[model samples]
Target: MAQSQPAQKYGPDLSVKLICPECQIPNPNVVEEFSSGDLVCGDCGLVLGDKVVDTRSEWRTFANDEGDDPSRVGAASNPLLDGVDEFETMISSRDGNSGISKELQRAAAKSSHGRSERSLMNAFRDISSMADQISLPRSIADIAKQLYKRVDEERLLRGKSTDAIIAACIFIACRQAGVPRTFKEVWGLTRVPKKVIGQCFKVLERAFGSNSPSMTPGVDTPTLNNVQSGPEDLMARYCNHLSLPVWLQSGAVDVAIAAREHGVLAGRSPITVAATCIYFSSALFGYPKSASEIGNIAGVGDSTIKSAYKILFNEKQPVLASIHDKRANVRNLPDP
Candidate 1:
């Protein structure tokens, strides 16, 4: 027997040109009556169409505007995750006495939530927790979670250590947020080795399509660069850590900026540069902090601070001269 072709029933053509029957106007301005689902003519009241779909958001509210929406169907969707709703079917253990609970758990696992989705969910939770542990703001947590999602989706670091990836994401997120933290700071929170985090950071840098490309290892990669923080950015934080006055921070930042512009602080890391500036700035302000104290806060050794100070001493003339507005008096600044 030959297969019969299915008969096609003609339906109303929505795209067909509409005109007001009373006024005989072509393509008349049609207004939608959402309450009755009728499209009426704008110039003259005429029902051009009926039963049109309403395409507005389903936002319900209580008596208070946008508050306590009891009739709302579901909670807001997370911008970071893929699930339409975060309402997972969780099964209670019930003191390990209920077999039904285990059965429910297995059933829930087999439902819409797959292994990969669960992994992503766990990763996002961990990212938020880690951010909270370090007292980082919610914004940083969101950004890190986004980076983790991107790396996983793009397979940019396939077969790589998830811990390392998370650590790198945290580090990158901090730099991108303009609160540039040292790898040492990130390393303290995440026991992942600095070498591994650094490697992962490089891989992520390639993922960006050519914005903020300079990847100098020890330099302060600017905001959105996801590199390291510069000495200038670290000045206020270090000053606060050391209980130094505000003037000291301002002076130290100027020194770092001058050293950066003159290209004299190339070989030193940002931490070392920052430490040296604080030390020099402290001396100028008559509140000198011991090298060991500044080194302790900046996460560098005392010897490293001394070496940076020696280098600064050699280039002291231009570094001081380049300060904007002559903030630092050449006579007040001391020899390293």
Candidate 2:
């Protein structure tokens, strides 16, 4: 194919389609030679035009007939998966296609997403979806993916409760990211039994050493921290959910932290301690949060909240004394 040379004159888009210039022929049979950017006289063999733009695409691809892709490429590979190079085969969708073709389609679809990749994809999606449902941050989703990837790489808990493991991954992601959620809250979101989730958590804890780095070396995924978040950590979220006033929210957090420091609610779940602090804070500030309300949000019973508050009541001076804000009048705090 010869390239078109720079012609002195460029013809208008074959205006001579109506008639021939030199031959005086009407409605000339002109042919477009797109390869060399020329239009020639189909009958008289004249160079009717040169330097004509081809107007055809110059790029092509070997990729599956995906729309608008001019280069040989496929979807971006996930770094989280161990396998990449997964192959695919296209099967005709037209009716009367042989059963062999359908079989080939199924095989290709399965191979295109390798078993490990498929599992990781599903787990990642579940983690993200669960996080969104619980109103957790995007960072939690990313971290959870990383943690799950590590677990997969190590082959931890082979053939075990994968859902519980995934739920535990999310549970750990929340605590490790510092915006912790209680196990009950995680249970509420995942519906995984708390005992099963806890068992899976232990497996993950050993897999990714709680006080140190993960099992694999040179991996960028950080080691898991203390999985159990403190009572004070729960107060901020619980207070916000209760819609307590700003002063009362702060006062509640202060009381919770003080309770933890003073061992006021020892052997109690962080959720219970947090609910107690909220109920106590409301009472002190005259904002009155019934045990039922706090219990419902905190995933504890009213009796549990009242019981914990009863214990927390005995240490009112130590807890309220920790409040630097003078607005929380100790004189107004009721004795339980």
Candidate 3:
């Protein structure tokens, strides 16, 4: 009776050359013969090796298999944590008999390492809360967290209030994301004064040097003035707050865009321009919101809105004429 050949194992894709001993071929094709568990010479079918092991991954799928397989073990680890991705310590609630001792817990709390860890945790928690309060997106929150981490790593938090540093980081993140939040708004939300936040922001920007994530490569750090909102950007938002009609809302946008196009908006605060646009558009459309009403919604004085409105109206006649023509055309359209 013929002896049974051992089953073969398949190896991964690899390019290798080996001489066949039996065939005496200089470089015989030595493919893994998986069915017989041997590495054999293709020319003579001579088994040169046996009992090979297949080291490929066991998880396999076919063309007809559903892609939503639930076999995944867990989420991928975050690289920021430096390989220690899980919590190493846990607090025990029970303090007597079967529980951890109070003295040990107290000692752990008093340690310098524990104090630093607690400070870091508290700062991050405050960042999350502030981000949520301001309705910031998750990407901005992540940027804030990254900035805070860098501050902590650089020991820049030594003499500064943690709250101030966190607020400053969030402010920078808001600017970087072009979210249009002002320092005044951040101060109102965080209760950290503007001066302290400003100082912290400057210190962080200095410490970050060329490595600052907020600064684009080859672009200088933007001044506070550069990041402020433009008139057109703020028009719709202020209009919405006042609950104006669609025509007035759209007219406000057109006024803002025209002012920008004609350079009438140069060196003007966007809030002021947006306020003026609202007041002007309301009057032009015959709904006529008061300067005081528009100013109150925009957080500017009525006098400022009035002054900006006159300048915009006088300097942008061509734009105003075009808008007037468009409105006349709309009114003349036959009702369906």
Q: Using TM-score as the measure, what is the rank order of every candidate, best first?
A: 2, 1, 3
Rank by lDDT (best first)? 1, 2, 3
Two-way TM-score contest, 1 vs 3, winner: 1
Count of steric clashes across candidates, in order: 1, 0, 4
Score candidate 1 by TM-score against the native: 0.66
Per-model TM-score, in order, reads 0.66, 0.67, 0.58
What's the residue-level lDDT of 225 in candidate 1? 42
Number of the candidate with higher TM-score, 1 or 2: 2
lDDT of 1 by residue, 1-336 (tens): 999999999999889877788878765787899889999998888887899899877775566665644555666677667643455456788946858888887787777767777788888888888888777888778778877888888898987788789888888878776776777887777777788888898888767524432233465435454345788888888899899878768888888888888987698878888898898878766787899999888889999888788888888888777764666343465655
RMSD (Cα, Å) of model 3:
13.1
Instruction: Report the lDDT tens digits of candidate 2 across residue range 20-66.
Output: 57676776788889878888888878887788887766455655556
Error of 1 at 264 (Å): 3.3
Residue-level lDDT of model 3, residues 1-336, one tens digit each, is 999999998987687557897787776788796666788888888888999786656564334356644333344543433342333355676766754666667776766545556666667668888888867887777777778878888788678888889988888877666676656657766766789888998887666544556434465544443564666666766777888876777877887777777888578777787788778777777676788888777788988877777777677576676677556522221111
Q: In candidate 1, which residue pairs clash?
A: 220-230
